[model samples]
Target: MVDTTLEGLSAVGDTTTGFDHPGLLYHDRDDYLGGARAFARAAVAAGGPVLVAVPGSNLAALRDALSDLGDAVHYADMAVAGRNPGRIIPGVLLAFAAAHPGRRVSIIGEPVWPGRTAMEYPACGQHEALINAVFAGRDAAILCPYDAALLDQDRIDDVWRTHPWMIGADGRRPSPWFAGAFAAADRFNRPLPPVPSAAATLPYVVIAELSRVRAFTAGQARSAGLTVDQTEDLIVAVNELAENTIRHTPAGGTVSFWTEPGHLVCQVDDAGHLVNPLAGRIPPAVTSEGGRGLLLVNQLCDLVRIHTRPTGTTIRMHMTLTP
Candidate 1:
């Protein structure tokens, strides 16, 4: 007999069924834990692999509850792997999903935990919405757990707009408030804040100009009081995105660098629309080719944002000059 907790584990059923890439969870401890286990238990029963990507404490919580069965589910501390919501797709979800092709996998991801800062929150919100665009179809069920008690009403409310499924202890239901999730994410896509007036700017329109771009960025970063480590990171990030612009756009783009109180900011803009929000966030696999630039930038920088539309794409990378 099926466990009652397994009820509504997958609102869209198995891999073949059409379902949203993300299912939003507005839950307290009990409901969250229950839903997590239910999905795992159900996946195991169906002979599918299960990955539980949450904070360390929650991993322990689910592991203790599942016991030997818990050993069956792979675990990663989402707090670390998903520190940047942009990274969760390639680092966690897609990595696990790619491991077992032609079969469905279950993933429990908690990217919007309570401790996430306000500056980071918008990207998290956009991350949740972009999940649909990244994994619109295929064989994976990604369950995003949100703590209702910890999150504000608006954050909770956004879940409805981003995810197609609403999971609770009682059962799963279609999100009545589900709007165009991608569009909603776009709404949260605020422009990259202005670079300080005192900062430096470098403009380029060709591949041949990349060296100059890097030299200027490195020099400006140092002038802004960045340490050697911070300066190096900014240089690498600026170089990569500048390279991406050359490869992706015909008209090339411009690179701008500046510094704030405790942070350094560099932005690259080009006439290219990056529809995939998860682009640089995901790590490339052994078999993968050429998408590691943005991922590298995310690792080197403290925070990153990409604003893309029909007109063009602007990728902003932020680094904390101090440890």
Candidate 2:
């Protein structure tokens, strides 16, 4: 049976079939601990696996609060493990859920936090919204917390649109602004800004040109102060994207490179369109022969954004340069 504490937060439909996801609006550290502790404790009492994936400071605090539970509760530092919001679903959430089959999983996931850059916020919002569709019909309750005091008003408002229910100091209630899963995903799928005029661009029309693509990527990444390992990873990621274009599309794509604040950005534009919304978000089965290119790219980069339509598709990847 689902814990009453989590179930009670449901103001709409039954949560038994479709998972329960609630946005916890917390103003301070005390408010965050209170709500998160209650939710986790109840799940532990129900004898289900619990995962607490939040930022570093919160992870430390939650670890102390649930110290008695020990290994009963699994903890991950979201700041590192979920640096790329695109990896949270496949690498963090689903991986934990799949570990213990036939059991309900409870998670405290805080993806959006203070200090998140403007470029990263959209991916975080879409990740929160897509959780509904990805975990549909699963036995899990994910409580996402938002720092109302730290995050801006716009982000707090997005919390409502992404989550169906919300928990506040008063109590739990339905979010009137909640937009359904797919609609919310589409809302965040805004087109990426054009590459800067100064960005270096190269076009590859054949698979044989892959070597040149890697060389070009390495030169640009190194020039932007990326470390040796960072340059190699960026090269691999760009190679995978360019190779995909040659293999899938009749016309190959163009690759561009530029630098942002502390990041080196690489973009690939092709005449092909990506139809699968969950393409890189889900891990491929062991028996699968292919489909690991984008997943590998997500793992290698600090941030990734994709814009796809009937006209064409553009994929942008960001790698952080060493200090």
Candidate 3:
């Protein structure tokens, strides 16, 4: 088994060829700005491409702080670009890295923030852990920032487990509690909470019933106050997942929908087992024949969570009622 406890490590700036995943535990705005600016500057000095993909407000602050770099540093609003944590790896990080081949890449990716909802936190944690696996041999460093003052203790602890290195006010060190990439991802691949008792559910037996699935999703989205565009997006996402069930599993599956405080949730359960953990996160090539369904769902919905085992697999898609 891979070593869960990462012992004997140096500071964050040790300069390694392999992937470096560091967690920046910043206590306040000033601390956040300082750490972020320093990382960006170091990347520029190293002559590699730099990408700062953080929440909108943080993106604005980094832009102002790094004004002298001009277009040398790329900026993306994580709130919009990475709204669905599942998309951050393929859509944002890897996409930027792919743009500049043969060059080491530096990225400041802040996926977790105070405003992240409980329903979204699991996916965020999983995303952070999976980054280590996705970029294992690549020459890249990703600095993930967590708000120490605003976020809860559980979230802070998760940061320690997901990242191989932790950076605090004092300095950086290897995380004693760091779990290997797959272990951490499996830890976050927990069974989703039960949907409300009132959630609408429908069963599908074959491809012929896909239209019914879309109609059901549309009805639930509209009833939950989703706008026309939002409803259409949810319908498409649900249809894609349901079709996967029909195409892959012999037993078919069930579709369910419900509403939380600020979001509408849709779920599909099938007997198929998804062996590939990175199934939907990586973008396929242009000439590829298949494998774009789940990626499309991740882009269409606000959040996507998957729980798969030998017995079955359950995929849930969340869409905010307001946006």
Candidate 4:
């Protein structure tokens, strides 16, 4: 219905347009390759920057197809770069778009794959939904491509709601399946599962107590067999989450850490409501006065789960343990 044209996007910068820019491009192998190549090449031909963030395999395929276009196309491994959906916006989408502010930038972001862990699927779903709000009226176009063969029908159903437009074999059209996108995102908002009984749990009442909490946690994490790098990441996440507690009343908060079969988890609880569901997920601008801490936490951890309410906010930061 809008500028969903992969062959060309000359109308991308037009302020007066119908429908919206974020569209769903669900495809199989052949369609994905052909459509993605055309999408990137078209952006280049129209003098707009194109960012392609997909898994490693797709990155390689698109690189080969668009290598001739020079710097018009940029690529990132979504598996690694977007492992944390919270980081996908500020880290991947906006970073590319901001670099070319004068023109309408195009992004092809593949967030969900067949192999995404169950623990990760919820946040990914929320991230896709939040994308609609993050760029609702901006001079940018994003086409989220879902793998039809790899993902189940239920997931394909979600793609229709998260994205307002669709690119099919018949060309682009407004998605009849789209709904109130942000409200749909709230369906995925949920509290993380309780910490395991084996988890090492502690409570700290004041900032002075945080140092002791950290020392205790470092020892426990190291004993739990966290690698040096993983340990550092865990500590950073812990410190940032703890720092947020300074704004709370003297009621204090709780901290928990544990090691699963092949993962390390650190969780923090505080009496603060996270009103903005989009907070931290979107990177703060260069001039942003605050809000960098949680963004850093998401980048350091392999996966993060959060549940916030009027009562409080609890966040779980996960790190993969190497054998």
Candidate 5:
């Protein structure tokens, strides 16, 4: 058994006093996934329940890989469940931690991509806040798997600094309070596949022009092997975003559709400046009316990015398309 001792614990990022873990921090996805699989084995062998909260996009693979784990695991779609930890990460952590009485619970996170950086959208700021909030005062370890392409390492380390018993990717064992969580770090140091690219673009663009955002998205959906119901969902998501460009802009905008490895992307670029940061998406509480368009966009797409400057706001919305 991997011993849990501060002397064995290695720190990666800056360390703080209040609430942080001291464990390994991995930059590679393969390493992270491998670590997760190893930790799961250890957790199950120890005879405790494993709670996994994954992004909607990652559900299929995660389930397939861990399916044999049986009833020992309970799964949830964190985004669909509206369990956003960034906004209220602390509360989310507390609630989950309380739900599992004595059994060790592992928190798994796979948030949206192109996350807000200090330079871009500040809204993505709470990654660590969510982790700290959930693990605060609790003994459970946390595993945060984010898209490194989108988030900066500086910001990630800033969040890692908060946990006292945490382990980064450097093979350190933090305080035992953070040991299980650190063990999570230790288990994740493996290999990953190369980043997958999108499919061809020529035929994809031709289809988008021939149809409205609705039809275009629908056609692509079918071609991408999506179910009829799934096609409808993708259509609704794309239509709203496409319509936003046509309706809210001065002249008009261009909508281009394409397919990546696991996502169907709809990009709308208009001549209008998005003076307001909160232009498109709205919260769910005000669902009495029809203003929750972008809000739906946020929930439906695996990733959503809006680049607005003096030029215009380029909305890149990605929907997961898988078999």
Candidate 6:
């Protein structure tokens, strides 16, 4: 009998016939490395390999910890590989499937700085959607520590539905770039272009020219074959950031989006110094009716990179689109 009432809990029937229930394990208590080792052993014992994804710093640690498992463990560095989660996660799954044929593989997400809620970064809507699409039909498990404050019940459900198992390392603190780096590693051989730059001649502030920028973004998405939903999400992120340029800059800014193999890169350039240090990040308090624009942008974009100078501020965001 299965415990139907437990939150995020379900029993997976025998795999010999077919996986009865999608296996999901939600344990929020354990040491990350220790849990990883145990999981690796189990996967190997079950005639499958363990794929460990982590930052470069943790590579040595993971290798040493899982040394006992010998050929059962495969290590991949998400950071050194360039941190593209879309490619890495699915690539890892495909590799495992090829090697084991019928057996399921386990994924160990040993994120650095795992348990701190303050480290949680907002994932762009497109990026999250892309991840879901990649893991669409695979039997795998992702283990990491839980941040109760950073994750809500609904978000947990989303994770469970996407990942068969979620083990929470109680005291561990995982890094924010966990999934991003993994994706990058999977496509390491490809040359990732530097984020696009605009010419100095590009007008800093010209509200009349907004259409040109928006058109360029849409064109880029279309050329890249991004889904309508992903393109729209990216567009929303662009609009919010562009509006910020108008509101904050004395001179307007340039907004641009470019296509990568599996990403939509966007930038808003403004000739204004954000006098407010927390300009694009901090949302307005509930009692306050205004100031939520940039906050909303932050929530919508996967990653936000800010560059400010005497001339202006340039905000860069990345949204992953299905390939």
TM-scores, in order shown?
0.80, 0.93, 0.91, 0.89, 0.45, 0.41
Candidate 5 TM-score versus the reference = 0.45
Model 2, 204-279: lDDT tens digits are: 9998999999999988987899988998899898999999999999999999998888888999999999988777
- Cα lDDT, all candidates: 0.74, 0.86, 0.86, 0.76, 0.51, 0.49
Over 4 Å off, model 4: 1-27, 285-289
Model 3 earns a TM-score of 0.91
Angstrom error at residue 10, model 3: 9.1
lDDT of 5 by residue, 128-164 (tens): 3334443556556555555544456654553344344
Which residues of candidate 5, in runs, are more than 4 Å off?
1-211, 261-263, 272-282, 287-291, 320-323
Clashing pairs in 3: none
Worst 10 residues of 2 by lDDT: 9-18
Candidate 2: Cα lDDT at 225: 94
RMSD of each: 4.0, 3.1, 4.8, 3.2, 11.0, 15.5
Higher-scoring candidate on TM-score, 1 or 2? 2
Top-scoring candidate (lDDT): 2
Model 3: runs farther than 4 Å from truth?
A: 1-16
Q: Among all windows of ten consecutive residues in candidate 6, which has the lowest summed lDDT?
A: 116-125
User: By the TM-score metric, which is better: model 4 or model 6?
Assistant: 4
Mark the regions of model 2 whose C-alpha exceeds 4 Å error after superposition: 1-18
Ranking by lDDT: 2, 3, 4, 1, 5, 6
Least accurate 10 contiguous residues by lDDT in model 1: 1-10
Better model by lDDT: candidate 4 vs candidate 5:
4
Off by over 4 Å in 1: 1-27, 220-233, 246-252, 259-262, 270-300, 310-312, 320-322
lDDT of 1: 0.74
